[model samples]
Target: MTTTATAGADAVVVGAGHNGLVAANLLADAGWDILVLEATQAPGGAVRSAEVTAPGYLSDLYSSFYPLGYASPVLRGLDLDRYGLTWTHAPDVLAHLLPDGRAAVVNRDVDTTAASLEAFAPGDGDRWRHAYADWREVAEPMLDTITTPFPPVRGGLTLLRRLRVSGALRLARRLVVPVRKLGDELFDGDGGPALLAGCALHTDLSPEEAGSGVYGWLLAMLGQQVGWPVPVGGSQKITDALVARLVARGGRIDYGARVDRVLTARGRAMGVRTVGGATWRARRAVLADIPAPALFLDLVGAAALPPRLVEDLAHFKWDGSTLKVDWALSAPVPWKNRAVAAAGTVHLGADLDGLTTYSAALARGEVPRDPFLLVGQMSVADPSHSPPGTESLWSYTHLPFRRHWRAEEIAGHVERMEEVLEEAAPGFRSLIVGRHVAGPADLEQGDPSLVGGAVGGGTAAAYQQLFLRPIPGLGRADTPVDRLFLASSSAHPGGGVHGAPGANAARAALARDRALTGELYAGVIGAAHRAVYR
Candidate 1:
């Protein structure tokens, strides 16, 4: 049943997710012949959209907002707007609502955001302005360091020069501090703390975690700087643009071609074999836009890997599973706090203690009685998402990971989530004309890379970040096997649709393929792999 192709391209990219498309595009730009193979019929992995709720109601299936995408140097360099990608934003960025009806809102306008924070507690406005000013000083270099390849020598030096050693160390300490502690240190009263805690929960990180402060500070600042914007039509438009750019560069993508085996000979990736028994060789390299576990254990097989690598992978951790519900509504949500209506993204949790309790329950493997929800009103952000006068809405909450979620269990959880929503916006459940729910299994089934509905590739824990990400090795895209690179969120700089992982992979592949330095590149990478893996 297996068929073999006579011709092989310079490189074979194992998935057509945004990361793979990005890697393929960069390689194609380098003038290398590239072929990308995808398991699903669609190009976008989780960055997709559909009308699952009702006709004329468009819902973003997985990720909807894109503050990171808008600011990403990798995405910006591509200039995807030329390929029919248009971005639009809601009037306000995000609002965090409390049960008492007090809300802390973040807007692109600094004055508006400062005034909103000041309403909850006096003098917080000046504190916010001070924080924003501090952020502006290190913003460019900080962002650059994050998006570049690991051991970001160039970016690190620039940042160090800007802040000096003592100042840099102080900033590092602030970032590593717990979100709860950081908020307590930086602001007075509950308003500022609630906003930071809500933003930290964007990842699986609890406010109590060591590295949680970074995510909280980074996202809240980005919300102010860029505003969380969405593609004009849908999230799928982002994917479509990446695809169009790749095709324009003569890169090829084969949908429905599931790569099951990475063919290796003499410890180098030679080609890949698909599930349907087709063999496609890679003349130069093979890049995988799949999870680390899938690439090392499932596709390559354990027998071919080093004992240390196999052991390291065993310690890898995935983030929490999630439950997402989409609703097609007859009218906009009637929020008790009218200001919430103006925002594209809303975070609904009573307060800091409520968030702590919810996160603690998830840590203990129990579904919290009160769920902290991240809600999106697509119609508010883009009118085309729904019919006139109606709304397209969706919200997602994290759950303990499970392979299977019973229908009744899902229904019960959905009911609990809706109850929380109704608390903030009275009569929220009444407007639903149609609804669709996706549990962990549904997300994985739609895109296998989203293992257990762990959207951020893996846990963004301090122990698993930077050089230690995916596994302890050179933090670059190079893998144990020569001519192979990890081009997925599982690599360093994990997750977000920034395409850094793919960009890093493409650069590595291109460097190894260079005529003069090819042998030297292989020698250095091989030594590093042996030192760590052997």
Candidate 2:
């Protein structure tokens, strides 16, 4: 049915990203009449993947691999496997190629990884295992606790309670420390820190950036244990699977509908206004899966925003922009190391200085002459991606967030990117039969959620985490408006393909009806200030 003039649903979701879809599923599961308003022609925001270059070639427009996919219990509970979503794993040899023609093949077995570490620095591998074991104690619960919605006081306490009284104290100290310190404290040489820093860079957090240490080691270890794999078909499979489940439950999705404003009255969120002038009203709640700044500043209107919320918005720090290059290859990326060639996701930074210089230059508003690039040989990782014996590769580097990009600049950048790839693999540029470049503007045109093309919503830096995320004083998911809530990567636990933010928002909305169920979540976020920041 077409939405009537006075039409209303139990819940209204703005943006059809995976988080919004996850939230919509939870509402529909509870028998709520739900309406999902999408700005794009289809669902799946950053999680979207498409065939950008060739007939058989597929490109991940945004997010591709998922270590977060495996860690998200909320996603696990959704029983995605029953929905036809399957995951593949690469071998333990997750490789990091250096300019010296040497590479680190991280294996799943701790002993094997230990041996790899040992090669770089004697006894360093053993230290890595020791550090990993310590992380193991908190990894599960920390992943659970941090991803909790606004009121995770009990969840926070639960995590705190679970911490080894002694270990917790140590972790508490480490939590605020930078990744450089954490890596340096644990490793005897630069290899562990270099490789680990590369992983955290995946989220746009520089190694020098505080709070990134957690993400760096966390994902690195997770990838070692579970090789970063794409869904069987491509990243689109994950989004399609989620949308299929939502539609199966009678959910309504309006595509090609770009939202321009969030309608509110009496300090409460009521609905949204699209660029087409269509209005959607929700009696229960509004879940926004876009950036918080885009919500309060662009969509929600600055005047309607609470004063503190406005101040909080000012303090928000968006990470740098990104430059993505996709290729249709005639064959696989013939990595110098045979083992790394077989690995699913390869980190290709020549050395520590190369990584630092690239990131530092991005900070200084100049593209690094030799940018640190994350090279994904998609077809080689999964054979079904391209024509027989052909492959599709994705490599990206961070660029300063400013100005529109030109076609010539992007072309030159692609050429430079191929040169970088060829450093690890001898004849990489020759195989490119097709290619596409997405600059900041292209990303903006593609998905508005990538504000200034900062793909992870915003940087996943420690300062912008949990309580301080998006802005300080409002970390509980709930915005200044009564029923409006943020359900995007801008929220707690930051960015990942994980549906935690969406799940967290749905549970929060459900709390208004259930009351006590989500109180623990609210409490945790509330406690951060009650305990420390205040």
Candidate 3:
């Protein structure tokens, strides 16, 4: 490893993931001299792409879709397009393959999507339209509440004004309902319910779990509003654009620099020491864009944290592990149902019942015999993903957290996934020119933040969500230690590439420095917390 003399920066950010880069960019934009240190040689964390399967095929190693990234309020202001970022979308956002040779397709147009569902059950089309109309009424406020700081006073007020007592109460009830229950209540057909249930599986939540309805509803609505998009060229384009913007603003990133410890003095973070024995001092703040456990236990040390916080960390639950496979396809997936061909994403596991069973198996610490899958047809979404006339396909399935799989077991899982694909898209296996597999252990090896390969930061269960995420308290980005912040997906608004946690952390850091704007923002957030909780 390369070593350099100790240097000082106004703000030191550990990790070069999208969130870390976002924090650095925001601080640097405010004229703070920013320094970012990443343990890996490359940035983007899970949002990365490479020719993993074949030289000509670009495969997203982790995250493929970017509905949240596209809709992020923090990212929208960045004007990433100016830095060479382009988005590509498929004709349809997603499709759920049913057992009866039919598909529940989600189109960007609500009418078209509802029409697709209407085929299965009469009147379901109108029901779908009604649900979307309701979503549209509060979409702006809902997005604002989620993407903004915790408590979301302004967002809450906006929502309250738009939705009076009765409406707000109804919406809140809907959010808390289990996906299975919500689907059963709203739609009579398996098509509509299956689509919603499949969306719930995007997180670790089962269809029967409370609070999962929100996940399903949010993704399904977002698909209609913004259609799942991918960065043109490859996901690396997102990282490249972010890096370009940061560099243009006079920020610097030091790759292959692993932070060993956070240097603190008198209960205030002052700097950080790297594994290379080189120390970089921070004059203002130290922001860690790593998981909470790693930041508190490894870098800052559990001894530095309060005993209660340490104890709370011990009980923090991880979502679940994952098994991802990327394939360089000789041709597009030969779907048994042609309607699924135009979709960028496809969900497999027959119906809601299969999904419920899959989730139950995961809860029992056993791999489901019929695992649910989230498949991405990269070339359909972005032609740049593969060579001419070819395709790049990827699929991922959830696994029990911390479960160890032997080589044979891993192989069996892979075979089972292929069989599931075959069931949905005949001849899908024959089209695979090359393939790459990343088991839970492999994912953790690539990015330590994906602890136990549990993506989405941690469980978004009702008990662990919102204010209780990572730990119980107001979900502010600030930590107990002064001038220190947690800017990872482990923070509020949970996961996805939204960059809210990073932006929130930067705002908190700025507030500590007595910046007037930051102070006012923090004040509003605090007031909102009081109003909501009290």
lDDT of 3 by residue, 1-534 (tens): 775658789999999989999999999989999999999898888888999998899999888889988998888888999999999999999999976778999999888999999998999999999889988999889988988778789888998899999988998998899999999998998888998889988999999899999999999989989999999988888889999999999999999999999988877899999997898999999999999888988999877766777778888888899999999999889988899999999998658888888899999999889888899999999999998888999999999998466877778999999999998888888898899999988888888788878887888898877788778767878776668889999989888988898998898888878755655744565555445433
Q: Which runs of model 3 end up more than 4 angstroms from their true locations?
A: 1-5, 515-534
- Deviation (Å) of 463 in candidate 2: 2.2
Query: Which scores higher on TM-score, 1 or 2?
Result: 1
Judging by TM-score against the true structure, name the best candidate: 1
Return the clash pairs for model 3, or none: none
* Candidate 1: segments with Cα more than 4 A from true spot: 1-3
lDDT of 2: 0.78
What TM-score does each of the candidates earn? 0.99, 0.93, 0.96
Residue pairs with backbone atoms closer than 3 Å in model 1 (clashes): none
Candidate 1 accuracy as TM-score:
0.99
Local error of candidate 1 at residue 218 (angstroms): 0.5
Across 277-395, the per-residue lDDT of candidate 2 in tens digits comes to: 67888888899998888888999887886566677678788888888888899988877777577777788855766777777877787867887888777876677788888888888
lDDT of 1 by residue, 1-534 (tens): 857764679999999888898899999999989899999998899899999999999999999999889999999999999999999999999999986789999989999999998997799988888888888888888888888889988888987998899988989898799999989987896788888889999898998999999999999998988889999999999999999998998889898999999999999999999987888999999999999999999999898889999999999989999899999999999999998898999999659989899999989999888899999999999999999999999999999866677888889999999998888888988999999999988999999999988898999888888999898988889998899999999998998988999999999999999999998999999999899988
Which of candidates 1 and 2 reaches a greater lDDT? 1
If both were scored by TM-score, which would come out higher, candidate 1 or candidate 3?
Answer: 1
Instruction: Give candidate 3's whole-model lDDT.
Output: 0.88
